[model samples]
Target chain A: MSVDAATVRRIAHLARIAVADHEIEHLRGEINNMLAFVEQLNEVNVDGVEPTASVEDMKLKMRDDVVSDGNYAKRVLANAPATDDGFFQVPKVVE
Target chain B: MNAPVRNPKLLKGDKHDWQVVIGMEIHAQVTSNAKLFSGASTEFGGEPNSHVSLVDAAMPGMLPVINKKCVEQAVKTGLGLKAKINKKSVFDRKNYFYPDLPQGYQISQFKHPVVGEGIVTVDMQDGSSFEVGIERLHLEQDAGKSLHDQHPSMSYVDLNRSGVALMEIVSKPDLRSAEEAKAYVTKLRTILRYLGTCDGDMEKGNLRADVNVSVRKPGDPLGTRCEIKNVNSIRFIGQAIEVEARRQIDILEDGGKIDQETRLFDAAKGETRSMRSKEEAHDYRYFPDPDLLPLEFDDAFIAKLKADLPELPDEKKARFVKDFGLSPYDAGVLIAERETAAFFEEVASGRDPKAAANFMINEFFGRLNKEDKTIEQSPISAEQARHDRRSDRRWHDLRQDRQRPLRNRLGRGWRPARGGREAWHEAGDRHRRHRKGRRRYHREEPGQG
Candidate 1:
């Protein structure tokens, strides 16, 4: 799990982000620092203690299971770069 | 229009007992109107960045105020799975840079996942059931979607989904087959739907699965699981597993070592492509999020959640069987989706559970299947179903056979469905209500009148 500089560089490439060489060292440092903090979490005895996923305790306000809104096709695609037949257009991916 | 779906199983040669080690990370979008930690509307379709708040956009001065409802939903999900609720937990910063993530780091539950060990039981067609163990369920915030090819060069980001609440339910490497995995996800989705925590819409990216697939020689230590990224549909996940497993088997069989890496399943290409080396939890450099403090709650609060929890799918399915006298399959199908289950219960209670089940499973649900319509979109009301039972002469004959008015008792009980299946039948046929049966009783068959 120790993210080395080369791994950082590879991750950037795979994630499609352009990272300068000097920044790789900075990324390495940041990753290592984060790992150090995570390492501290292991000291706590969580053998049987359940982990908390959600922070609060309130019910999600239930809505009547009714379809209320449907006439928003134009609104939905208003910012689309390209669209056709009420659907967003993309480079043909399947063909 | 349908495209030819190339089956991967065909190309997968030989039924070798390669230990297929599979794990899953399922992300379910919490059914909430607002974002997880912000008041911004979480509506699906909105203008680009319209739903983005200062907090969601990662503004320097912005702060996150947790949505209490989201937490409750998470707890409800945990409780529904019969998992323990934690008294205290912390949100950590999973730092990774992605254009879609306005904040350089995603706020997620890491070391202390909210829920711990649980089990999901899947019924096989052979009247047997298998139990799959759940490792953990963690919470996180969703990132925006980056739309490439929107223009020749410029990629657009839709913040409508950014900062939405998510529960990442992780499963143990217990599955050995595609069918089992499918059943696991199906059951998990059912439990969530029953709890009213997630909308469970895979097409809209509300629910997605990350499949960890690997192959090992039998009795080999757990193989290195290569995580297949972001399969949005269940069918696609199954297909990805088959393709990835076979690809690995082909490599190992030919003396190639399996590389532990993250791979992407290009559904369009019908293949998996190596993306990069899989990153460990440390690679993200997770730290206690400075913006938020560790979440702490009392047992009383958890008890309240436990108290208010809806009858989970399994319990409800069993209740349908024990109380309503429904077939296990019918009960299972009805409870798989929450609303469908509710609609079935509405139709069944007071009416003969068997007759109501027949109409729901056969008459209403069957017709919907024939027309490729969803139950939510169906025009049928429970009222019309009851009316059909009362008025249809064939139903009356069945009632005579039973020596009692089953439809009458049901109508007397829940008046709406008592009107009968005519209204639902009318939904599929624009003119059926005006043309169909008027007698109050009939046998459950065609041409029985």
Candidate 2:
């Protein structure tokens, strides 16, 4: 699908990325180019191929359900921009 | 003679016979030792952020590995619901920005959920049963808690809940009344608790529901639905549905259109208020996460999980009816919770099930209710109950006569509860006051010490 300026703005907002007004045109062009390059695969005649979610044909690696890590509250909250009485602080969010 | 089945109460309007339809999206926190993709402790009460892992905190280089027990729990829950366990399920990035959610997007199942097409049967108080169709059950990550009361201009985020596993079970719009909706959640919670998948503690925020309520004419096409989000209490869920149905009926009767939007239930006000307009809502850009692989398991895995499944609420209820010869309503009440069912089974083994039901239901439960005590907190022991059942003459005659008072006094030194009801109430008042003073520390939030 072709990308438009308004669509690019929406996409940027959804992704939580700030895009400048002048940068929308450039981003849209780049996105449309990528889509077009991927669309070229439509010309291939292999219709019976199964749709694959990933390139790797493998099972998911799993970890045992055990509490092996944690109890590092200070380290966990070390990078927070703000911290309160033992909690990471942020600007008040309205629902 | 068994009384005729009573229809569930319906809302009567001015002229139109309005019908209420409800659907529920329940978020049940999976019971696991660690978080969904992190090694963070899923323990409820800990120092804030004390249970956080690098992955839970959303560090740059952190990656999520699938927790095998979580997937197995989800599958077991699906089987308990009589739902299909999809062999191949994929996780998607549900993109959104919120302060509590450290990651910009949450890993959830969108199109290909792990469980599909299940059925949940709800038994009503009036000796009636109805089946609610399960659309799907998907595994997702939970967001942290935002404590708004800690500061004025700032909200504190606790990463303890971050990266925890949740099973979002969605139901079809098959419920007809608020009572049915409440019953559905209760039954669903019981099944989940039985499966050991979720603790099903609503007060702890382990289980919360998003109820979709709509109103329509008796035979007219379905009406637009308004979703009330994040209702944590069963009583409030029933109230929300009833209040929302009335609100919609008023709008439709006044010749106005009901907008499809999300609303919040204000328990204190006993009403639902608009939280967001449908037009301004976020369009969550869901896409398959590239980091995670597709979750695929064979039939043998499902069969093994199935083989290990405990007897669910329905199975136990049926057994109670067939073996104990208790009424359907009595059987439902006895088997509502696994602990209560087990307690009853142990006390009633080799004894008259109907007599046991009577003693347990009328005498034990009545005393517990009067004492304002839960089954877990009951002072009476099962051995005491068995002893009372055998030696007490009142128990042998309680079957043929309904008016006979239970002569067996609970505990060692306690007096008979039949004639001392008033005295007990007075003592109960004193005990309640004493307990109230001690309850201050226990009243804190589940995760807060």
Candidate 3:
């Protein structure tokens, strides 16, 4: 699969990245190259192979239902750009 | 009452009859002590951000670990719905941007869900039932709350609810009317509560529904459907469907086509307004999450969960009718809540089943409702009723005396009949004294006192 200019713009928008109009073609070419490099796997013939999410053949790890963490609101919001009353504050978002 | 019929005449348009179709997607918060992927407390009404963890806050280098109880809850809910539990399901990242979602994307299921198709049989108020097909059930994370009114030019975000587990149960477009939609949600909530997966509390925002509504002429093809989002109450769900259907019909009759988009229901105005147009539809751009592996379980795991399942509402209702000889209406009232059913069973054991049902339904529940108390908050206990059978008589007397308020009667303390017990005790003493006298005359055993 190859990425076109429009696809690049859409991706940038979805990722919340501010991409300039002049750089769309360059990003498209860069993305297409990446996709082509990863497309080498298409050469292999493994029709019956199962699709797996992880490289390791292991199931997801699950932890017991216990409340072992929390109550450190100060540290959680310490690095926020803005905070008020222990809440992360942002510009008013209506809707 | 007559059985409910799916009458197409119910939705009559200006020129022709129309049929309103509805489907629901219910988001139920998983009842867990901790967050789904973090060890943060999932307690409701906590101080803002007190339950936030590094993972929930999306801090750099922080990872999420799956909570076993949330997954188990999803599987239990699936079994309750009689749905197929997928042995392997993948978590996908649905990319979106909102202030409440610090991750800039939601970890959800798209291509592969935890549960597949199932059917839910909803009994209508008119003594009829219909089956609504379950499209799928998926597990996802809930977003934080964005309080817009906190400030004049800014919003505050509470991450207490972030990373909490939610089950998104989707249904097929099988509902025929607003009543059917309401009944469907009611039944779904009851089932979820019975499974102990979700509390199904709409007022607390534990359960919310997105209703899809479309209208088409009879025997015509399906029309473009619009979704009414985040309807929090069952009454509002019914009203939303009716309002959206009327809106669609009016547009179609005026030679204007329906625009498929998302709309928000205004409960105060009793109408629905478009939230977003189809041209600006969301492009979620879903992809598998690299942080977590595929969730896979074996047949043995499913069997264990299935075996440990409690008798659901439907089964308990059936048993109440068949074994206790209760009318369908009476049985329904009894099994509406799990606690109420348990209380009824305790009161009915080793007693006349029908009479116990009548007493509990007519007298017990009636009095509880009058006092605005739930079954758990009942003043009378099942053990008290079992030992003191006169409570039934007291209830009858209370019912006869309509002037006496329930609070007054209860405050007076519906005590057991001490007079009868004292009388029996006195009679027993007199008989024993007589026997002792006879014994003294026959065998001279007066010293045996």
Q: Please identify model 3 stretches exceeding 4 Å from their true place.
A: A1-4, A35-44, B1-9, B277-281, B386-449
lDDT of 1 by residue, B278-338 (tens): 4542268787886776766778878998898887878888898998877787787677777
Residue B368 of model 2 has an lDDT of 65
Q: Write the per-residue lDDT of candidate 3 for residues A1-95, one digit (tens) a residue.
A: 99778889888877879999999999998999889888987888889998767677777899999998899999989988999888889999887
lDDT of 2 by residue, B267-295 (tens): 88989999863334358779899889889
Ranking by lDDT: 2, 3, 1
Top candidate by TM-score: 2
DockQ-superior candidate, 2 or 3:
2
TM-score of 1: 0.74
**If you assessed candidate 3 against the hidden native complex, which CAPRI class would it receive?**
medium
Which runs of model 1 end up more than 4 angstroms from their true locations?
A: A1-95, B1-16, B277-282, B390-426, B429-449
Candidate topping DockQ: 2
What's the distance in Å from true for residue B371, model 1? Answer: 3.9
lDDT-best of 1 and 2: 2
Model 3 over residues B284-305: C-alpha lDDT tens digits?
8789999989888899988999
- For model 1, how big is the CA root-mean-square deviation? 9.9
